[model samples]
Target: MVDELGARFATAGHEIALVGGPVRDILLGRGSKDLDFATSARPEVVERLLAGWANHVWDIGKAFGTIGCRKGEWVLEITTYRSESYDPTSRKPEVSYGDSLEGDLSRRDFAMNAMAVLLPSHQFVDPYGGMEDVANRVIRTPGSPEDSFSDDPLRMMRAARFAAQLDFTPDPAVVAAMEAMADRITIVSAERVRDELIKLVISPQPRKGLDLLVATGLADHVLPELPALQLELDEHHRHKDVYEHSLTVLEQAIDLEPRLGVELPDFVTRFAALIHDIGKPKTRKFEDGGKVTFHHHDVVGAKLAKKRMKALRFSNEQIDQVGKLVELHLRFHGYGTGEWTDSAVRRYVRDAGDLLSRLHVLTRADSTTRNKRKAEALRSAYDDLEERIARLQEQEELDSIRPDLDGNQIME
Candidate 1:
C-alpha cells in the first residue's frame, strides 16, 4: 500500500515519507495497519494523488493538512508537513503547513515517534537521534522537554504512556519537565486526559506508566484517587499498602482476563481491580476492638467510581460496568463454607447479570493474600460456587430448575 502511494507521489515530484508511529513500530519489528505520511504535496494535491487508488476519500482533516483515504485492504492518512501551535487556555491546536519535514518532526511528542521512513526510497529519517533513543529504550522529546511540553502539555502524559507501552523510561529531564508542567494537563480537557489514561491502562506494562504518573505528580492532577491510596493505614496497623495492592490486583485481573474470553477487552476488569479498594481510604473507621474497618467500602467505591469516571468523561456504560463490579466485589465473602443453596446460586447468577463470568475473575483476583493455604481455600470455595452455578444452568435447561444437582452435591 505504501509502495503504491510512494510511487505515485514520487512520479509527481513530491517527496512522501511514511511517518510517526508506523515508522517507529516498524523499526522495532512490530507491524502497523494504520499508516501516516508527511508529504511535500499539499492536502488538495494529496487528495488528488489518492483519488486514483482510493476506494473512498474523506476531507474531514483537510483543513489540518490531512487527507484520509482507503484503498483495497489498506487505510492511510497522508498529511502535509505540519507546524501546529496550541492555545494555552484551550487544548485545541492551530495546525498549519510547514515547508520542511524537520519542522514537522520537531513538533512531535517524542523522538522515537518523530522518526520517519522516506517511502519508496526506503530511507530512514532520524533528525533527533530517534534511532539511538529507540535502541536505548528511553523516551525523550525531539526538542527541549520544557519547550515541547509548554506547546502541548498532553505530551507529558504521552511521555508516561509510551514509557509504559514500550517499557522504556522517560528521560530525567522529561520527568522533571512533567513535574513542573503538570498543571498544564488541566487545560487539555477531561476527554483527552481520559483517552490517554485508557491507552496507558491498556498497555502491556500499565504499572510502569502508573508509577511514573504517581512519581511525576501527574496522577495528582489527572487521577488523585490513585495516589490517595498510599499510607492509608487501618486502626490495628494491619493492612497491605492499598496502592501497591491495587497495582497487584490490576496485574492479577489482567492475568485472569482469559477467563472472560479472549475477545473481551480487559479494561473493566483492570479498572475495577485498580479502583476496587478506593473506598478504603474514605471509609476507614476505628472500632472499639482496636481494629479498623471499611464497613461499606464496596458501596462507597461504586459511587466514587461513578463520579470519577463521569468526571473523566467515561461513557455511562463503562461507568456502570466498573461501578457494578466494585459494588459487588465483596459479595462472595459472605458465601462461607461453599454452602450456598440452589436459590442462592440462582440469585448470584441473577445479580451478576451478563457479568457473571467476569465477577468470578474479579472475585478470585481480588484475593492478594500471601498465605498459600488461605489462597487455596478461597480458590476451592470459588470453584464450588462456579460449579454450582453451572449445575443450576444445566438443571434448569434439563428440567426447568428441578434436575440433578444440589448445593450439597456441588460442595462435595
Candidate 2:
C-alpha cells in the first residue's frame, strides 16, 4: 500500500518520505500496521490526490495539515511538512507548513522519531544523529531537550512512553531536563497526559518506564499519588515499598487476566491493581505501639482514584470500574478460614456486579505477602470463597441476587 502511495506521489510530482515513528520502528527491525508520511504537497492537494485513490479519506486532521485515510487493511496518515510553534499558556500548537523535510524532522519530539525514509528511493535521513541514538538505545531531543519539551510538554510523557515501549533509557541530559521541567507538564491538556499514561501502563514492562517517570519527577505532575506512596509508611512494614508493591500488583493482575476472565478491557484489572492501595498515603496513622494503620484505605483509595482519574480526564465508565475495584479490594481480607456465610458471598458477588472477575484479580494481586504460610492460607480462603460463590451461582443467579420473591408475588 505504501509502495503504491509512494508511486502515486512520485507520479504526481510530489516528493514524499516515511517520517516519525514508523521510520524509527523500521530501523529497529519492527513492522507496524500504522504508517505516517511527510509530503511536500499541501493539504488541499494531498486531499485531492487521495480523493479517488484512497478507499476512504477523512479530514479530521486537516487543520493540523494531516490527511488520514485507509485502504483495505492498511491505515495511513500523511502530513504536509510542518513547523509548529506553541504559546506557554496554550496546549494547542500553531502549525505552519515547512518546505524542508530536515526542518520538519528537527521539530519532532525525539531524535529517534526525527528520522525519515525518502520514498521510492528509500533513502534514510538522519540529520540529527537519530540513527546513532537508536543504536545506543537512548532517547534524546533533536535540538535541546528544553526546546523539545517546551514545544510540547506532553513530549515528556512520550519520552517515558517510548522508554517503556522500547525499553530504552533517556539520555542523562534529557533526564535532567525532564526533572527540571516536570511542572511544564501542567500546560499540556489532561487528555494528552492521560493518553500517554495509558500507553505507558499498557506497554510491556511499564514499571521500567514508571520508575523513570518517578525518578525524573514526571510522575509527581501526572500521578501525584504514585510518588506520594513512597513517603508513606505501611503497617507492620509488610511491604516496605508501597510504590513497588503497587507495580507488582499491576503485573500480577495482568498475569491473572485469563484466569479471571477477558470479557473486559485488560486495563480494568490492571488499573485496579495500580490504584487499589492509593488511599494508604492519606489514611496513614501512627498507632499506639509505633505501629502504622491505614484504616479504611481501600475506601479512601477508591475516592482518590476517582478524583485523580477524573482530573486526568478518564471516562465515567472507566472511573466507576476502577473506583469500585479500589473500594472492594479489601473486602476479601475479612473472610477468615472461609467463614463468610452464603449471604455474605451473595453480597460480595452482587456488589461486584459485572466487575466480579476484576475484584477477584485485584484481591489476589493485593497479597504481596512474604510469609508463605499466610500467603497459602489467604489463597486457600479466597479459593473457598470462589467455590462458595460458584455453588451459590449454580443455585441462585448470584450475579443478580435479589429478594426471594418479586413485588407481584409479595402482593399476591
Give residue 363's error in model 2 in angstroms. 0.8
Per-residue C-alpha lDDT of model 2 across residues 1-412, encoded as one tens digit per residue: 6777888888999978999888889889988767999999999989988887899998858888989998888888999998887887775888989988988998898989999888888888999888998899999999899888887889899999999889899999999999999999998889999999988887777888899889989998899999888854445554367887898888888777778756634776787798788999889877676677788998999999999999999999999999999999999888986578789999999999999988988898777587899888888888889988899888876546666797899899
Error of 1 at 344 (Å): 2.4
Off by over 4 Å in 1: 233-237, 262-264, 288-290, 400-412
Q: List the candidates' TM-scores in order.
A: 0.94, 0.92
lDDT of 2: 0.87
TM-score, candidate 1, is 0.94
List where candidate 2 sits over 4 angstroms from the true fold.
Answer: 232-239, 263-265, 397-412
